[model samples]
Target: MLTVSEKFTAFRIHKDDNNKISSGFEQLSLEQLTAGEVVIKVAYSDINYKDALAATGKGRILRTYPLVGGIDLSGVVIRSEDPRFQSGDKVLVCGAQLSELYDGGYSEFARVKADSVVNLPQGISLRDAMALGTAGYTAALAIQRMEDNGQVPERGPIVVTGATGGVGSFAINMLSNIGYEVIAFTGKTEQAPYLQALGASKLLNRHDIEIGTKPLENAQWGGAIDNVGGETLAWLTRTTHVWGNIASIGLAGGIKLESTVMPFILRGVSLLGINSVEMPLSVRAQGWKRLASDLKPSKLALIAPTTIKFADLPQAFDAYVEGRVTGRTVVEIDASLD
Candidate 1:
């Protein structure tokens, strides 16, 4: 059987007295890991907004200090106490309190709970899984649930808020690939053509509808896959067509929801909450299966990360936080052992 070796470089975050996050490379040992049933020789990890928050200590994403700060990781399993996984099994762990209660995938190695592991389906590379990452998973989950709830191509157009971000971009592509007319919403008007290339039928400026704190407003979109919280969510909830379901996933804008019950009570609209983290293993596997099947975007390979070596993690994390980064940013670890 294979094993995790000694002294793997990890992107470590240390919180100071002021709660400022300071992240850099540090050598870690298996003994430093929190308890789990399996150990992964991390092959790839992509930067997400949440990871940016933890890396920069901007949003209180991590519950613990001095932890590795990555929420999504894909790699080969080296050791396992669980029957479901074995050595050489390619797996992925998203959410599950990594970068919070435990060290995460921004490392050459990681130990994760067996329950959090999802065996990669055929045609999905371990590295591509990181490109899809947590953001892509959540986006796929939203689209899946929406379709499961009777959303279809005839439903005018689907709205995707935060279109330039990871989740929104992937959502647009997935929806488009599956033949849904998608209307992307973003603050970045300059990215309109780029989004269109990913199958956005149209684009909506954020300042136009998502700015106000109105309780409710005009109904516009037939369906929605919303990642931006706060007014954006509220706006989408109000604007969604009757019986339309909007999946609320991320809280990038803000978590506060000050909306009237009119959309739900009057229009029969539904706000489905999406929690990719702590989701049941069966559900996660199902989501992955969906990703492998219908929800896999045609342009997925284009959004693949710009791979950087482990030593560049610190600067990469910083760039990720500063919003200068686009698409996925993958950290490449030593793959020889795998």
Candidate 2:
């Protein structure tokens, strides 16, 4: 158990009087953390595009200044006012508004709201939990939502945009493991082998495919898990087959939707928005349950190949921000806890 008087290392983000964003490691005590019922000895946290944005000031990710900057964490509980958890329980928190509404996981110890914590599901290790992080979790949520909306392998191939990214990688693997033919839509066609290993049946290079200007083009995909928005998403809406579901996960390309409602009305195409945050606890629990069982990525190691020490965290964000990274990078805060 961590004593209240002990100082722990935390990566904190702050905005100054001049409104410039800055972040770095600092020593912090338990009382300095935001309010929460569970105090965890953080074992692992993973890097996401959001984490990069927060740490580098590339995007506005924090609603409060001087907050710790990790959105996903896996750890062991040391103290809990919540009846659902107790000391030594393995747990995780993802997309719970950490770093935005409260101090987050990029610390040796994290105090998180009881509602935000999850008992780490069986069949996945604490390390594996962080390896999945929000990226895999979001991918699971998207797949679950698609299936719930009546999507099946018989519907035809599911096109996963941003296929080289963490979410896309996990989506491809999980979808394929469950017998869905997965088509990877990516700009980096050179990563064909990598995508193929993740169970993509085919690859569609974004640069080569002429995105038709018609309101609805010939339906090419049964459904899609879209990470890129704007033209790519518009293309998905137009090209998806009848009764198909398009899970809109990210807006890496652009947020504007210029397409008409032709697909939704004419073909019964459903556009499901996949927001990892703000999910009900029941939904969150079920998603993690699936992630541990049926939806578990068979190529988990391949998708998240990098694990770095906590001290190396600052140097890792640039690759994510610059879009030079592939797969996820786990930040090992205390591997001994695992």
Query: TM per model?
Result: 0.93, 0.98
Which candidate leads in TM-score?
2
Q: What would you estimate as the lDDT of candidate 1?
A: 0.83
Cα deviation of 34, candidate 2, in Å: 0.9
lDDT of each residue in 94-159, candidate 1, tens digit only: 877898898899888898889999999887888778889888888988877887888888866899
* Candidate 1 Cα misplacement greater than 4 A, ranges: 16-20, 210-217, 335-338
The collision pairs in model 2 are none
Query: How does each model score on lDDT?
Result: 0.83, 0.94
The residue pairs found clashing in candidate 1 are: none
Error of 1 at 84 (Å): 0.7
